[model samples]
Target: MAASPTPSVSRAPLGTVPPTWLGKRPLPETSDGFGVRKPTPPELRVRRFTLPDTVAMLPGTGFASAVVTPAPARVIARSTWRPGCPVKATDLSWIRLTFRGFDGARHTGELLVNRTVVDDMVSAFHDLWDQRFPIEEMRVTRRDELDAPPTGDGNNTSAFVCRPTVGSSTFSQHAYGLAVDVNEFQNPYTKGDLLLPELAGSYLDRSWVRPGMLTPAAIGAFAKVGWEWGGNWHSLQDRHHFSRDNR
Candidate 1:
């Protein structure tokens, strides 16, 4: 005799309400099980949307490729690190996501940020992604590469530079994994006659408003989470620098 076919368990569709248990009433279609109703369009805001329990999606449909994840062992080993650093590997996270490059094609890159602001960092990038902003490149600051002279390092979009203040003995916010630099080539750090990226002299003319430059959207995104951009500073302007502290 042929055995009866096994019953298959049905599953709810993504973003839809799940099935009700034997004793419970069916949940509202819009309820997300946390008693909060999902906001409709126009009210929907950027969110940390998780997919497959490992990837975080950016706002909008086409950006599903944009995801954030913990740093891999190889990434940690390559990043600028040393003993007695203010932040340890456990205190930081690695986010891997797709970003639009200056050429308008998708590129995958990684960023290392403190766990304290990982969510904020992701949110900032999400806003940038939604705006279709261009990022030159994003990579971890490799310890081995830090020894190289800083003459033409401005184009590197990096975070967690384990270093102290340029002229002070105190550790900089970057040493704590609390700061980030974006599109350094297009957003040079300027102080007096000095420019970090010697080749980025043209970007000093912010009125031009070109790709890879800081736009209002980018500023608003970082500011929303209490980060201060170097572009807004006086005395010394580091247009590529963004940190949690204004000092």
Candidate 2:
């Protein structure tokens, strides 16, 4: 039999809850059987603020392509980078690439990564583009976004956020531009009772399979370049995360 055509996906604005999740009861536990708990008061406070999605979805110009250049200081000023960040701005590279979107159209996206891994990142993403893997959005994350309210529905594909590992003071690989998170809403961070995009519980049911969700092919694309997928971690499942050191 012929394969079914891919379903077209509508791009919902950030913070918009899918109808499927509305009125659904909070997940009682994680797939590992660990009981889910409520977010703390501070976490609840952060969720009160909402930010609009402002990424410009430009049409892809041609074939899948990647351009890596020095990360401009001016652009770095707007990102999470600071004077004391782990990596120097001069050691970072700004990458512009084309990706297939869930809309089944081509789109342009950008990322900031360590210069040392520029080739690895480019090669992996180029393979993903060739595989027609869809990404919902990709853009540089701003420093101010660190404190922004949790929309619990963001799906931005990003790298190089100057933040520490969750629940720890040590710097995360992303702080050094050595890690990336792709389609985070489709592949959320889950540990015990905590989920980064809190409303992303539905995605834990990976059996449903949806566009933009990482597949074994996608994992292999990054793995071929020596990056490790967080989904393989036994202590926690960070389905959207990939890093050079498997942190």
Candidate 3:
């Protein structure tokens, strides 16, 4: 009998077979899409179809944790105050504070308030920040822009406005930069059939609380500074308002 033909063997280049066909190898440590480094030599010895006691291995499982730095000191600039207003700039200050925005991100806001309340404003806002209360916007109201309609107009977290109280010629507390209206769209000024934003009917029910609405904690925060809430008004309810009046 002829000698058995030598067994034949076939070989292919390293590039021939798909990677999946090869034996499993350690995944190379790489940067996550967000630039965070993925785990190397993973903390857990997870196997196929088996979950670890802790899920720390899951991608993005942990939060970066919000870091609210020390609230910065108040900053003053020309644009921070309205030009030639009834209230002198010297009596009013531009306060810069860190606020949590409606989107849950950190933001810097400016409030033009009477100098007497700057310290109180800082302490109050710091408490608000620690509580993560949301603020829509905060800026100094320009004297020229005060002529715009107060009701149904777009403004939020404004302090100073040279305008009279509704239906009264007497200047409003805002005219003296002693009041602040926060998250107006979420906590509107209302009286009878009228609403400041006009579109804030949803917030009419004080029972239903939402982000940016004044929680008891927020009210307490301002109260600590001797600020009164407009929600306590007799006729109209200005849930978003806070002022240090009759102090």
* C-alpha TM-score for every candidate: 0.71, 0.77, 0.63
- In order, the Cα lDDT scores of the candidates are 0.65, 0.76, 0.59
Candidate 1 similarity to native, TM-score? 0.71
Per-residue accuracy of model 3 over 1-247 as CA lDDT, tens digit each: 8898998788643322223411133222223211112221211111011111111121232211211222123333423344545666567665666666655666666666776767787888888888978775666555444433322323357776667776577878877778888777667777775565643555667786666778999999999989999988988888888988931
Clashing pairs in 2: none
Q: Which candidate model has the greater lDDT, 1 or 3?
A: 1
Q: Give the runs in model 3 whose Cα sits over 4 Å from its true position.
A: 1-86, 149-155
Error of 2 at 211 (Å): 1.0
Clash pairs for candidate 1: none
Against the correct fold, how does model 3 do in TM-score? 0.63
lDDT sort, best first = 2, 1, 3
* Candidate number with the higher lDDT (2 or 3): 2
Residue pairs clashing in model 3 are none
